[model samples]
Target: MSEATETEKPASSSNTTLTNAQKARIERNRAKAENLRQAKLVTHPYKIGPNGGPEGNSVIKVQGTKYIDSGGGFLLEQPVLPAPGQKSNAEAETPVVIDDGINIPVKYEECLDCGDQFADSYLFNNFGHSVCDKCRDTEDRHSLITRTEAKAEYLLKDCDFDKREPPLRYISRKNPHNVRWGEMKLYLHLQVLKRAMDVWGSEEELMRQHESREDKREVGKARKYNKQMKQLRMEVRSSVYTKKTTELHVHEFGPETYNEEEDNYTHACVSCPYTETFEKM
Candidate 1:
């Protein structure tokens, strides 16, 4: 009896120990059975009409209750239809209420040109200038100027436009002259003029500075021209002379000869074609 029991225990242990694949398959089968049981709990209580009529179109009448055939195998229970003059449960649920009166009033800005309060305008939105769109004059007063033009005409530096107390606003645009060039920054001409006045203290001061700079520029150009001419002359003179540094020809004269009329001793260099004449008392 003891020997038989030992053999039976080994056999039972071997049978109980399942492989990984067998375990996974058993788990999958158990999950499928549970899903089937859950599906059976909710009986599709709708049914189709005897004839293919309108009643069988979008609904399935299983047993007695009407179930919506949602195209797929799934069916939805028919909700209790609300009587006439009554909203459905979905419609009866109050929608989120947002009172417009509770919202804070929007602050309107006074337009510089029109003197009318406006909530939004192109100039106000882009450049912070409280001007209405009707007063926006792209051709003159409210015109846009390129950064280069602003710098040249107003004598404003990068700091004036960017690093000043209140930096000027600008819009970036693709270079109109050449798309390959870097983007161009455009600023309001009116703002640039105002900034220029601030930088130079007044329009008169700006004009005086312009005149001074122009005179200095002319003087610089003249000086540069003179320098260039001087360099050109030096180059031409050097080319003509062809300066050479050869060992000095120490007058290795054969003999010093006296001139009869001139009364001077003359000597010629033997190594180079150089001659010298001198008078000695």
Candidate 2:
């Protein structure tokens, strides 16, 4: 009787177990999750060969690094080609014809007055006018006409109208004793009358004085000279008529009348009664 001690029963040897259908379902779910992950992988740029194959099968080699896609296996390469009746990209971009007008060199000439380079058609001679045709036409119309007319009128009005005279005759008068009494007297007394020409301060002043007494003085002197000349001409005509000779006639003798032969008189003085006296003297 071992003091009636309690003894533990031996543990039962039972193992936990699952059905076969449950294990197959778990394997199928794991395969589906792996396929989804492979679809999400991105494709990168790659080179290809002529036979429509990637440079290195399904694996991309970038800087010696290999990237593999487990799902698609490999990607094919397609070469880009031009469409029918279409030019190639390089040929289409090239220009066919160049602009020949731009390449031609232009010719020019120097202007005579301004010494500036201008086209051949632009060259012109001004002659008396100072400005060009375009400038003259565009500017005042009276400019060209006024200057030309002024010069012409001035020349016409200022022309010398006085004539030359003949040489002086040194004739001596006979006295009672058969000796020469009077000194030699020149036949012609043509004088350039130096009448006081009005000296105005300016052109405007002269124009203002043209209607004054100074202008009248000039006119009076001209009239007196003309009257005296007419009287002398009448005297010569009277003498010629009285002589009843066609060759010999009367001439001016020191503001007086003198008889001279026609053969001695080569030409007549315009202002005086002498015949070519001033010119010969």
Candidate 3:
């Protein structure tokens, strides 16, 4: 009976210890539930109106952050303040940055006039010429020439500019004279001269070809003028004069002459100066 009582006493102490541990766990769970409820409850600092709504302003401060009612069933946080001495986004200028993710090395060309290496220039961009912008002479050296003018002045055909090996480059622009007209193709004057030399062999040869063409053109013009004048004269004569049909005339022989050496006979017509010679066969 003593051993059983001692065992019962140990069991009672063990039960007491378990009860205290369970009570501690329950208290901790209750504190956690209260914290969750407080976090879920949103409190607005503004005064409540009679209609049980926030007064005047739609702004609300939560967790030290101010948020405005977005009116679309959501709240928007206030814009972050810009750093001191830095311009606001609206007033700041956005810099343009180009990133192609390519590390291609730029090739430079020596300018014809300046003899300086450059990566790009107006003439180079438009015509693939090596002349830099500073040395470009738009009115003289690097002047633009119309395709028609180039062809006419250089005596170059379409094949020379387009079909030849390494075809020439040109720029197109709307016709200044008439916008409705076809766009005009412009080529560099110096390049045109070089192409002309290539086609004609030399500047002297080109000049000679030009002179020969001019002479032929003049002759053709004169011939055309003469033909036109002849047509005009014939028209005038036809309008002023009337034609009269006449019967064919029969020649009347006046006499016959004998050629002893040739052994032939010749006869002369009486009404006209018509003569006839015949051999008696």
Among these predictions, the greatest TM-score belongs to: 1
Candidate 1 vs 3: which has more TM-score: 1
lDDT of every model, 2 decimals? 0.81, 0.42, 0.83
* lDDT comparing candidate 3 with the true structure: 0.83
For residues 233-253, what per-residue lDDT tens digits would candidate 3 score against the true structure? 667667444665574987799
TM, every model: 0.56, 0.22, 0.54
Candidate 2 matches the true fold with a TM-score of 0.22
lDDT of 2 by residue, 1-281 (tens): 44333222222222234458877888899998898876674544355555534443455555655555433565333333467688877888998886666566765555444555654331133222233333333233312222223323222121221222221122233444446554322111111111011123345554555456568888999989967876777676666547755645555344323335421224454546555421111
**Which candidate order results from sorting by TM-score in descending order?**
1, 3, 2
Question: lDDT of candidate 1 vs native?
Answer: 0.81
Error of 3 at 241 (Å): 8.5
List candidate 3 segments past 4 Å from native.
1-102, 235-242, 245-281
Q: What TM value does model 3 have? A: 0.54
2 versus 3: better TM-score goes to: 3
